[model samples]
Target: MRRREHESLTAGPVCPSTRSPRYTCRKLECVFSLGHPSIARLLTIKLGSGHAACIRFNRSGDLLASGRLDGTIVIFDIETNGVARKLRGHTRQDWKCVLWDLQDGSRLRTIRFTAPVFIAELHPNTHLKFVAALFDDQPILVDATEELVVKRNFQSAPKRSQLDMDEATEKILAQDAKQTTTVTTFSPSGDYIIAGTNKGWLNIIETASCQTMFSTHMAGGVITLLRFAPGGRQIVVNSSDRIIRTVHFPDLTGKNVDFGNFRLENDHKYQDIVNRLLWNHVAFSATAEYLVASIHMNHHVYVWETAHNSLNTILEGPTEELSAVEWHPYKPFLAAVGIDSGEVHLWSVIAPQKWSALAPDFAEVEENEEYIEREDEFDVVASEELTKRILRQEDEDIDVLTIDPVKGYGDHQEGGFKMPVLLHQDDEDSEDEIEAIGAGQYRRKSPGRGRDRNTANEATHQNGRR
Candidate 1:
């Protein structure tokens, strides 16, 4: 039998005849490795009650407020991962809106209406104030600090001229009456409040006066969702017709508009299923450059470029039906989505890479090498002289004409037409002229022929007749 080599932990594999002991070499094993990780799921909290109907994060991002179909609102502390407060007293008919203290997971107040509350939004400027839309009544502004309705404006339905109408018209009118306000939001400046109805009517009301400034029908179906983009200059409206339109606020001219007509790629099989679900979801990015919308029952989120009204990307991670989606306030790439499976997911725009480098340091350097090199190459003296020369040239090109006060026209010569330059008179002179005119003592020049010329013409006509 052939002799086998003996291996030892700390001994050489060769025999002792060798000058130096040759130990068996092993690859180094690392305990820790450094690399850039791609965007992925961070943390998920299961509510046990299935899907949450609505979720909103406070301004400080310390607390998350979620409302469920069981008419309960749970406020969760992000850091501690505990339920800070639980609020009750709402019905499960529709989605409920809640307001909470951003710093602490404390329930500020809850506003309940007689009908189903379809939409609620906190005032952009006021912390403890918000607005809610009701099914049977008008939208109301509630002050959480005082726990009362500060402003309520009910929109009156259009009246018919004659009480006697056809049966078809009356049925149509009855259907219209059943429609409710579905969405409500405030302008960025908090100057105006916009509300949408199920019947496709959009009303823009001035918050200060509580009066409707403009009202128009946007589309035929319900207005599912409406959001005022950053800067509050434009608003995006999503209707049940699957048409997304961005309109200029305070104008509503519908001109120079950006529209996204969503059509499923291969939706022939899922058309009926998707039509049954209600899609009232829309989210705007931090910079308002991108918009993410949840397609009802489609298990897909469409990321759109607001400027071009085209698809930027398609997110297809949700396995079940989607409930809602919200974008991170500060991070443009990060977004949170809620699905019917009782799981909330976080997504980012970063792609996975094999050979990754540390995220480029955003820290500012006092003196950058490239900046210093460019500075040395720049001709500062020449630039300064050129700037001064351009300024001087602009000043020279400016024509500064002095306007002189009007002077009275020279005495009328012969029959030449002359215009008198009226001068501004003193107060006393104005008063005197007014009194003289009132007393019928001021004779105004007649624009027609003079009195002497008229008398001479009349005398010449009489002589000719004789």
Candidate 2:
């Protein structure tokens, strides 16, 4: 058996330089100056030994769980600014999940797998359980109370005698077989566990039955992160192919088909950059309205709006590369960003308004006299004409007529055809009408014109009406 060496670091108050334009720090408070407004860092706890890989705050915000690369899990009491318990296991591999006693951090449970664990997520409804993705293996659900694997997808290999195969052949076969689980997360309802593999496949398993509900390939590259939105109706995925996408999960109660069950709603492509650091970190806001992701090897974070499928904001990080980011569960306005410099920054979306020198004086009579007069004039006009203007009709009657040149002239009389009456006075007075009819705005009289002309005019008017 190998013994493990453990080390723990305590929190201390450190004030950063106020003159620096990028970061502003005071006692227990650090404000990051993004272009528009500043975000304040509420608390900072420095871990002395290994690089911090992941951090999670309990529901009460009194306890914080931080995991490191050296397989050391430390539980910090935020109220006291001290370490409550430090557990050591799975040397050299990253600590995937750490469950601590929120009341006093007395009871601690750490889960270690045969291969390194890439992702771990606590159940939203319960604190004593979590789901973890193991390297080259299926995901496992850990029971914190019993400290046992309640559910897992492990398959036992067939046993063989020594004569069946040589040791060298078995070693070569084992080396050739490679599988990896890159990321895993629990759904908001705690009924399903979502896991992603290196082959760009995602699997959703039922927690009660431990059966796979849906599994399908998502992208070409490895999947980096799988996060369920606050409502659990949708999930956001980040992959090594530089694509961030959102998938929706509808009611999957009676659906029998396996493949193509998940539907993609939106996606965003990130800029290409050459760096070895893992840029797959993604998080959703408390309200699930906005999503934040770290850029690969870049000192910037992208904030996206799920509704618009557009970039909403860019949060600037430190000069060093960003490692991870977590949003406050209860505080929708606060966010914690972790950088490579071993510093965890606290940022707030809400900023204080700074008073300007040209602010208006609301108390002075002269300053508001013009506004008051305009308001009075607007009120008088609105009351007097608003109703009338709303009720007034602007429609005009349009007359559509199809006239035939031959039938435009009335029925023929004994002398000549009776000319049609012009609706407009200008047309009646025109020289063209006089030359065509040999009369100005009048019909020529003939011997039998009285009754015949009247009957013919009445028939023509009736035909025009039809």
User: TM-score: which candidate is best?
Assistant: 2
Question: For this target, which candidate reaches the highest lDDT against the unseen true structure?
Answer: 2
Alpha-carbon shift of residue 406 in model 1 (angstroms):
66
- Deviation in Å, model 1, residue 411 alpha carbon: 73
Q: Candidate 1, residues 139-165: lDDT per residue as tens digits?
A: 676655575645565562322224334
Backbone clashes in candidate 2 total 2
346-412 in candidate 2: lDDT tens per residue?
4554445545435754343435444445545645575558667755643544456743333422332
- Tell me how far the alpha carbon of residue 4 in candidate 1 is from the true structure, in angstroms, after superposition: 80
Candidate 1 lDDT (Cα, whole model)?
0.51
Ten residues in sequence with the least summed lDDT for candidate 1: 3-12
Estimate TM-scores for all models: 0.53, 0.55
